[model samples]
Target: MSEVAFRLFAERGFDNTTVEQIAAAAGLSRTTFFRYFGTKEELVLGRVGEFGREIADALAARPAGERPWEALRRAFDVIAEPRPGETGAPMDIIRLLSDACALMTRQWEKTQGWQSMLVPEISRRLGGPGPATDMRAGALVAAAISCLDAATDAWTAGGGVVSLADLTDQAMGVLREPGDVPG
Candidate 1:
């Protein structure tokens, strides 16, 4: 199903690919497709809720002494790493997202959701939520997501010459630097 979705997304663009088309391409009924994915965006994003949960779990598992931001940074590094059997080229996916406002909005919402889920875990790790802990968690998660987005955009614009890790590091550097403007 994902393979079909990826090919259709690649060929026709994400916004142009209908759920019915994806379903037909996959030799499944529309009902079956809906059963598998709640929406066309889900077909493209593909189990992102699961990935977010995994990220949260990873953040929760970090060493007790590590700062919440550090734990999240480490967790993000691991999440951003390419794994076996992932569908669609990262650059292509990034480009598709950049070109689609709806996808970009969805991506932003997903990032926010991930961050929200991470906050309690981070607060727990910090032994409780205070103004400082809350602020740090929000800032760290926001910075990480911003960096990931910028890195993806840079990688796409560079014709995929730069690895996602490199882009991520660049994003992290921008975040760490004092007085850097938000992109």
Candidate 2:
């Protein structure tokens, strides 16, 4: 279903494509399409929300004693790796989302949603719950997401010539610097 939708989105352009078109292309009924996806946006960006859970789960799978920031970075390695049956490259999906104004806004919302899924584990790594730990966890999650956005923006601007995982690590690494941000 997604492969069909993605190909259509890629070929026809996301804004130009319609749910009915996607359904017909995939040989599914409109009702069946609605059963599977609520909207055209869902067909494209649905996996995004799921990636939050995957990242959180990845964080959980890291060594118990790993540093919080390091664990988070390792967790994101799962994201840089292509999905089992993804129809587009990570760069292609980034381009797709950037092409549509509404999806870009929704992507921001969905990415922000990752914080809630991540805070508990981060807090645990910060030595369990408390005002300081919770606050720190929230900040760390925000910082991590910011690093991802920075990496993504860089990737888009640089023609995706660099591996996104490497760019992400570079963004995260910049934060670990003891000196001011490089100009």
What is the C-alpha lDDT profile of model 1 across 63-101, one tens digit per residue? 878766567766775546666666664445566777777
Encode model 2's per-residue lDDT on 22-138: one tens digit a residue.
899999999999998899898767778877898999999999887888898899877665555557555567878878887998999999999999988888877756534578788
Best prediction by TM-score? 2
Candidate 2: segments with Cα more than 4 A from true spot: 83-85, 88-91, 130-133, 178-183
| TM-score for all models, in order of appearance | 0.77, 0.88
For all predictions, the C-alpha RMSD in Å is 4.3, 3.6
TM-score of model 2 (CA atoms): 0.88
Assess the local accuracy of residue 61 in candidate 1 as a C-alpha lDDT between 0 and 100: 83
Winning candidate number (lDDT): 2
Residue 178 lDDT in candidate 1: 44
Which lDDT values do the candidates have, in the order given? 0.71, 0.83
